[model samples]
Each structure stands twice: as structure tokens, then as C-alpha cells.
Target chain A: MKSLEQYTRFIEEKIAGINLEEEPRKLYDPLRYFLSLGGKRMRPILTLISGELFQISNEESLSAALTIELFHNFSLIHDDIMDEAPVRRGKPTVHIKWNSSVAILSGDVLFVEGYQQLAKYTDKRLPILLKRFNETAIEVCQGQQLDMDFESRDDVTEEAYIEMIRLKTSVLLGCALEFGAILGNQSEETRNHLYHFGVSLGIAFQIQDDILDLYGDPELFGKQVGGDILSNKKTLLFLKAKAISEASKDARFGDLLQMAPTDSKIASAKKLFEEIDAKNASLETMNGYYSEAINSLDQLESKGLELGSLRELANFLITRKL
Target chain B: MKSLEQYTRFIEEKIAGINLEEEPRKLYDPLRYFLSLGGKRMRPILTLISGELFQISNEESLSAALTIELFHNFSLIHDDIMDEAPVRRGKPTVHIKWNSSVAILSGDVLFVEGYQQLAKYTDKRLPILLKRFNETAIEVCQGQQLDMDFESRDDVTEEAYIEMIRLKTSVLLGCALEFGAILGNQSEETRNHLYHFGVSLGIAFQIQDDILDLYGDPELFGKQVGGDILSNKKTLLFLKAKAISEASKDARFGDLLQMAPTDSKIASAKKLFEEIDAKNASLETMNGYYSEAINSLDQLESKGLELGSLRELANFLITRKL
Candidate 1:
């Protein structure tokens, strides 16, 4: 199996090969700029790694990987607009660099381009791949809607939040892995296992993101710490902290949660989070998902396929400090 | 061959059968509201009528027809947001009724739902159909971008305007017909001819729309006369009048064109348009396209298919007041 580094390198090269210099410079330029801003490229790498596990050729998997990456960027463009975000990856977002209308239209073009890439597949697997892709795409939109809906309501439950994240974030991961498995001609059972594995890992990844936002080293984390707190984001950490503070009748914790982001308020919030074991509780929940992911891999091992890279990658994702 | 009314009825029934009521009511509700507003449903009718031309069953073509309709509505939702217009089909647009964010996300889900409909076809035709759909979808976005671009510039030529309309409006018409032709198992020669036929007819239809916007009966037009004039929209008539007035140095025509739409300004602009024969020029251009479209149908007639309904439909579209 290829290393994660190799898969990432392969995916990057394929992404670079995508011709974004089409006419209507206004539309295509923003798309090119957005893609060039570069996230971790994690979703496409997962697709490649999963495809390699199923013995699918890197060449055959490139289009599917590109599809996932393009779709991810498309979501980012639209989500950034909806969020009224000005920056992404330390750079001006497409909507900021161009305008909202340009961002929206370019994002739409990017989506259609993703399907154009998917249409390159000629095997019998194409129909199922397209179907799963459509479902995943719809789920991602629904997830965004729920996330937006949650922002206006104060009574959001943990269960509702998890379901929102699953729909918004995790399903794309599952869909990526499933695309690879399908291309590799893996059994349906194995495909389901990989999908579940991706879902669990994705949940863990998101929770880790939540944890890191408030706790990670500033230099290593690549953004301002306590951003979620500043924005009053309803992440798992904040939700748990709120729940614990309310249950204990801790007025201090409640004050800290509602306080504006001064250094003291942020520090006090962190102290309270530690006091109530919110950090560890979040970590424990994350670890549970990690375990579930590993169990899924173990189930897939019965099929007699090597899963060394998958295991290694999952470990890296769950444990990464950055 | 089916009558246009039969095709329209069939498409309406199929559309009514589609269930959009599901979870995420915020997202789906706006879509339901938009679809219920009811445009002419012209594109899908063309698909069904073209399908009948090739002896394809209405049932077999239903999914494709639905795909075209859904895509059209999806484009409308997003375009309304981009245009920031308050009304569609004489009712509140999705963005106006709900919000831009809801409109944007719902439009996205609507696009994916269109693909979901496309994925229902599991035959050799699926790849080709998807390829055409993707291409047509991309072209639509590009066309919209050009339309938006034209809004900011005053030097847009008649040819450029024609190309813009082709991308924005004509290609979908072409795609709808080609989809029907493909499903009908027609020859490539026939498919190409039908696509061109749709394109030419689409251009004629748009020009006719421009004419009706200025001259049609108010009750039948269902819109305020001189709206394009009021908005300074650079339609074929406007561009042609500007060109004629500029070339002849007819300052009255130039003055009328630049004047804001009051009753006097609209009346004067109409008088200037008649003086410069802009109305006749536009109708002549429309007839040129109509002839090109009929010529395309003539090429298809070598295959011994009856095209009377297609001809009648084209005539009806060109002659319709609304």
C-alpha cells in the first residue's frame, strides 16, 4: 500500500493538472484562486489510500479523488459566503476576492466540473458511484442547513449536533472511501466497513478540531486559538462545557462562557473547562470514535487485504497535533 | 406524435409525483415554494415532445424530463439570488420569500436532486446522458456569468449579446431536446440536428420575448410593459436601436434611449424604435433564426420521422404573447 505522503503527493499533482484557465476570467479565476489556497487535501488522500487498499490503480482512482477535492472546495466557497467569512487558509476567500455572485456561480461551476470528472469512469460502477455522490452532496447541503439552523436556536442538543456534523462533514469522508472501494471491486460488506471507518474517523477528526481550537499551541495550530469561543461556536467542547456548568449551577462557568474574548475570559473559560473535565470528556468521546474506527478496520481485515497504511493514517489523523 | 398539451400534462403529472417533503424543512420548504410558483415548464415539455419524436416512451423519458425541469428551477433559485430580484413568475422569489442563504443552499440541493434523477437511468445511455447534462450545466453557469458581466459594461455588441443568450438560455433548450433524442435512440446526425433546432428556436423565442416585453398586450404579457426599458436591460432591441441611432447620429434616438422610464420616455423610446425600424430589425433577426431552426428540422426529416408537432410547438412558442 502507498504511504499517506505518496497518496497526498499524487492527489496534489492531479489537482494541479486541472485546467482552471478557461474563458470568463472572472468566474474561473476565483475558482483557481480558491483551489490554490489549499486545505490539508485530506478527503482526496483518504480516497486514494482507500482505493489502494482495495487494489485499485492510482490512475483509475485519480478522477474520483479529484471529484472529492473539487466537491470539498465547492462546499467551502458556498459555505464561506453563507458564513460571511472573509478569510480561509490565511487568505482572502473567493467571495472576498471576487464578489458573492462570482463566488456562487464559480462554486456552481466547480460542482458541475466535479460531475464532469466523475463522468470519466466507464465501468459498471459508474451508476452506483454517481448515486452515492449525489446522496453525499445532498447530505452535505442538509448538514450546512442544520448547522446554520443551530446557530439561531439556543436549545441545541448533543445528539442533534452530532447528527448535523455527520451529515455536514462525515458523509463526504465515507463517500470518498466508498468510491475507492467500489472502484477496487470490493464486496459490499467491505465497502460498508470502510464507509463506517471513515465516518468514525471523521467524527474523531472534528472533535479533535474542537479540542485544538481552545487548547493547542498557537504556533502549531495555524490559527488563533479560542476562535470558536470568540465566535460563540457551539462545538462539542462548548456544548459540553455549557451543559456541565448549567448542571452544576456554576455561575462562574456560565459567566465565562458568555464573556467576550479578553485574555482573562478565555483563560477563565479554559480553566473552567479543565475543572469540569470538559476537555477530557471531549477527548474520551473522540477516543471512543477512534476505537470504533479501528474496530471497523479490524472487521475489514477478515477479507485478507493489507491495511497497514489505513491503520497508520487513522492513527496519524486521530493523534495529529497540528 | 403527442400534442404539446399532452406533453405538458405528462410532465406536470410526473413533477407533481416528486416528493420534496422530507427532513430539513428550512432547505426543502423554499424549494417546494419555488416549484409551486409554476413557470411555463417549457423545457421539460420540449424534452418529452422530442422523446416522442423518436418513439421513446413517456415513462422512459420521464426521468430525463424531470432532470431538465429540476435543473431549470435550480438555476432560477440561484439566479434570483444573484440578480437580487424580488419576484419570479409574478410571486416572491425564494431568496425574497426565505433568504439568500436559504436560497443558495436549497438551489444546491436542487442541483444535486437533478443529478439524482439522472442517476436513475442505468443503461448504456447513462454516461452520455450525464456527460451532456454536465456540459449543459456548466454552459448555463458560464452564460449566467456573462449576463452578469454584461450588466457592468455598456459596450456589449449584438453578437456578444447573442452568444450570451445562447449560453444562458439556448443551450438548455438544446440539451433538453438532445436528451430526448438520445433516449429515443436516434442517430447522432439526428441528435445534432435537434440540438441545433432547439438552439435556433431558443434564440428566436428570446427575441420574441424581447418584442413582447415592449409591445404585447398588458393582460396577456402578465408583466409591466417597458420593464426592460425601465431597467435599461440591453436586449437585442435595445442594442439594435442603439447601434442604428449611433450610426445615423440620431440624437433623438440617443436621447430617448438614455431617458429614465416615465410614460413620456417610454412613449418616446417606442416612437424612436419605430423610426429606426428596431422592431422590424429584431423581427427579421428572429425570422432568420426561425428559418435556421426549420432547416435543422428539414435535415432530420430525411430519417422519415413526422415533425409536425415539433414545427407546431416552435410556431406556438414564437407566436405566444406571454
Candidate 2:
């Protein structure tokens, strides 16, 4: 099995090969800068691993892998503007370094580039790939809208939150896996199962992200802990906390939650969170999703001859600390 | 030839027929709303005329026509935010009605829809159409950047301004015509000539826009008269005036020109502009382009058939006061 560092290096090498078109230099320079200031590159690497699992490691799969990653970064650029996020991956966001307008246009050009890259596939898979990518793109936009909408509402259900996360975050990962399967010439059933594997893994990953936002070690985590709490973000942990702890019994907890979870409120919210054990509850829910993801992987094994690479990917994704 | 109002109604009726994908309601609602606040829909009608001239009114041509219009509106939504313009076509701008973020996302979704709409063509035409569309899209972005960049610089040449407008406003029209020719399966030479025809016409149309901004009847214009002057926008008039009226010979004109064309400076700028007959010079320059546009139309007669509908469309475009 390839180590995470090995996967990271592989993605870096792959990303370096992408050739951005000229003339929209302003629009694409930010893409270059942003990708250079790398994150995990997990999505593309997972795509590569998924392809490898199907015993397919060719230029086409590598290009598909890069296409998804480009698409992912394009979303990040636009999402950062929507979120008003100042930093990403321990660096200034594209919008912050430039202005929001440039970021918006740059992100737009990147989105176009993403599709342009995907269109490089041979005619047989191109239509299917494009149709799926377009559907996923639209869903991601809808998920983002729901997430923004949730910020204003107090009565968001855990189920609704999970569904929103599924659309916003999970579907793209599913797309990455499905795209890999297409490149591998896998059967439709295998592709669908792999998609489920990706979706479940994504949900687990996002839930873990929510947990780490409150409970992670600052030394280990790249971002400020409890950032979501401070922002009053509707995450799985918060939803579970509100759900499991009866409102009447947690009236004080609600009152404290109204304040930004800063130095003073952080302690109180932590105490209340502990009282509800929302962190552990979120972890348990995450584990359930992770278990389901593993099960999907197991199901795919029935059809697959080679399963080692995909299993390693699932394990690495499910077990990541940050 | 169709009257302006006849063409306008045709555009409105045709645009109204566009449908969004079901579900993911929030993402596409703004597109519907933006389209509902109707403009003249001139671009698509121009495309339709291009197709109709060749007697090519198939599903692919109609979809291509619709796609161009959608792409135009998509750009307008983003451009409105960039311009910080509050109103469009006598209604609130999308960014003003919703937020910048929503406007951004909706515009993005519409962009994708434009491509999806284009994909309805046969595979033979699809690649060429998409490639042209992509080039035009990138050119549009570059043009916008040049427009924005013009705001900060005092040294913008008239040639540079013309090129910027060509990139910003003309390329898509050219692509629209060229796309129709491709759909009609016209020869490459014919298609290229038609493209140039549309581009020359686009430049004339834009220059006429500048002329109307200053001199058209206010009620007919549906916008602030002398707006370019008020903003000290580097329009054709300003560029021409700056080029001809030497700073030494016309000290007041030079002084007013150096200042930002804000409301406070607008009266003085107008006085200085009148001193140099800048408006008249701009109109004369506009006429030159308009004449050149007509000449290009005359040149298109040799392409294949007479292209009577395309000629009519060009005449209508150049003759419009608003």
C-alpha cells in the first residue's frame, strides 16, 4: 500500500503536468498559485487509486483524476468567496490575495477549464462523464445554497444537515470515483458501488472535520479549533447536540451558544458539549458511515479481481487525523 | 426586414421557452428571475438571423441561438456586479435583487446550462462548437479584465480601447455567426467570412451604444444620459478627445480629463468636452465603424446565397437608437 506521503507526491507530480491555456492569463494564474499552495490532493489521488484497484493505470485515468481535482479547486475558489474565507490551507485565499472580483472570474475560468479537461476523454465515455459531471456540479451549487440557508435558520434537522453535506461534499467525491471507474471500463454496478463507497467515505470525512473543529489538537490540526462553533455553523456535532439534549434541559446551553464560542464561551460550550457528549456521538455516527463505506468496498470486491489499492484508500481516508 | 419591435418580441418569446432542470430549485431560480426581467435579447436574435439566412432552422441551430443568449445574460449578471450597476433593463440588477454571492452562483449555473444546451448538437459539430465557445468565453473574460484595467490607467490608447471592446463585446457575436455557419455545414472560408462580418457589426453596435449613451433621447435610452461622462469612463469619446486635444492646447479639457469623471466633476467635464466637440468626434468615429460594418455585410454577399436575413439583422442592429 502506498503511504499518504506517496499519494501526495504522486498527485503533485500529476498536477504539475496540467497545461493551462493562454490569453486568460489573469484567470488561470490564480489557479496555478492556488494549486501550487497544495492541500491534500486527496480527491485526485483517490481517483488514481480507484483506477489502480480496477487494474487500470493509464494516461486517460490520470487525466480524469486531474480533471476532478481541477474541478474541486475551482469549487474551493468560488466557495471561499461565498464563505468570505480569508485563508485556505494555511495560506491567503485567492480572493484575499487578489480581490473578490478577480477571484470570481478566475474561479469561473477554472470551472471552464475543468470541463475542458474532462472533454479530453475519448468519445465512448465522454458523454456519460460529462452528463454525470454536470449533474454533480449543479448539486454542489444547490448544497452550497442549502448550507448558506441553514446559517439563518435555527430548526435545521440532523437529517437535513446530513443530506446537505451529502450534496455539497459527498457527491463530488462520488463523481471522482465514478469517473475513475469509467476510465477503468468497470461495469455500471461496480461504478455505482464505488460511488457509494466514495459518498459514505465523504460523509465520514466531513463529520470528522466537524468533530476536529471542536476537539482537535491545535498542533495537529491546521486550522483554529472550534472555528465552526464560533461561526455558529450547523454541523453534525451541533445538530446532534441540539437533538440529543432536550431543549428544556439545555436552555442554558442554547443561551450560551448564542454567543460566539470565544475564550469565555468556548469553555462553557465545551462543558455543555461534554454534557451532551456530542463529540463522541458525532464520532459514532461518523464510524457508522465509515463502516458502511467499508461494506461498499467489500461489496465491490465480489466483482473486482484486485482490491488492495481501493481498500488502502478507504482505510487511509477513514483513518485520517486531520 | 423585421422591425425592431418585431425582432424584440421574437427574442422575448423565444427566450421565454427556455427551461431549467427540475429540482435544485434555488440554484436556477435566479436565472429564471433574471431572464424574466427581460432585455431586447438582441444577441440570440442575431444568431437566429445568421442561421435563418442559411435556411438552417433545425433544433441544433435554435439551441445554439438560445445558448448564446443564455451565455450573454450570464456575463451580464457578473458584469453588473463588477460595474456595481444597480439596475438593468429598468429592473434591479441580479446582484442588487439577490446578493453578490447568489448572483455569482446563478450566473455560473447558467454558464453550465449554456454548454449543456450546446451539447445537444451532433458530435461532429459539438467539438468545433464547444472549442469556439471556449475561445470566445476566455476572450470575454480577458476583455472584461482589460475593461477593468482601463479604469486605473490614464494612458489607455484609442487602439487599445478598440481592441478591448473587440475582445469584450465582439468575439461572442462572431462565434454566434460562425457557429450557425458550422451548423449549416458551410465551407470554412464562408464561415470565417461570416465571423468577420459579425465581429465588424459588433464593433459598430458597441460604438453606437457609446453614441446613444451621450446623445440619445433619455426616455428611449432607459438609462442615465452622459453616464460615461459622469463616470469618466474611458469610452471612445474620452479616448478620442484625449488623443486629439493636446494637454498644452486645451488645458481645461486636459485638466477635466485627468480627474475621475464623478458627479462633482461631471459638469466641468461636459463643458470641456463641448469645447473640443468630443461628442461630435465620437459620433463621427462611430459612423466610420458603422459604415465599415455595412461594407462587411456587403462583402458577405459573395459567401454563398444573398444572406438576406443576416443583412436585415445587421441593419436593424446598427440602426437602433437604444
DockQ of each: 0.85, 0.39
Write one digit per residue (lDDT tens) for candidate 2, span B157-255.
988888999999998888888887888777787778778877877887887788677666778877777788766788887787787677447666557
* DockQ of candidate 1 against the true complex: 0.85
lDDT of 1: 0.88
Each prediction's whole-model lDDT (CA): 0.88, 0.79
**Residue pairs that clash (backbone atoms under 3 angstroms), model 1:** none
Error of 1 at A314 (Å): 0.7
Residues B1-322, model 1: lDDT tens digits: 6666677777777777787757799999887788777767889888888898878877888899889999999999999999998989889998888888999999999999899999999888899899999999999998999999999898999999999999999999999999999997777888899999999999998998898888888789777788888778999999999899889888876677678778777777777788899999998999999999999999888779789888888888888763
TM-score of chain A of 2: 0.93
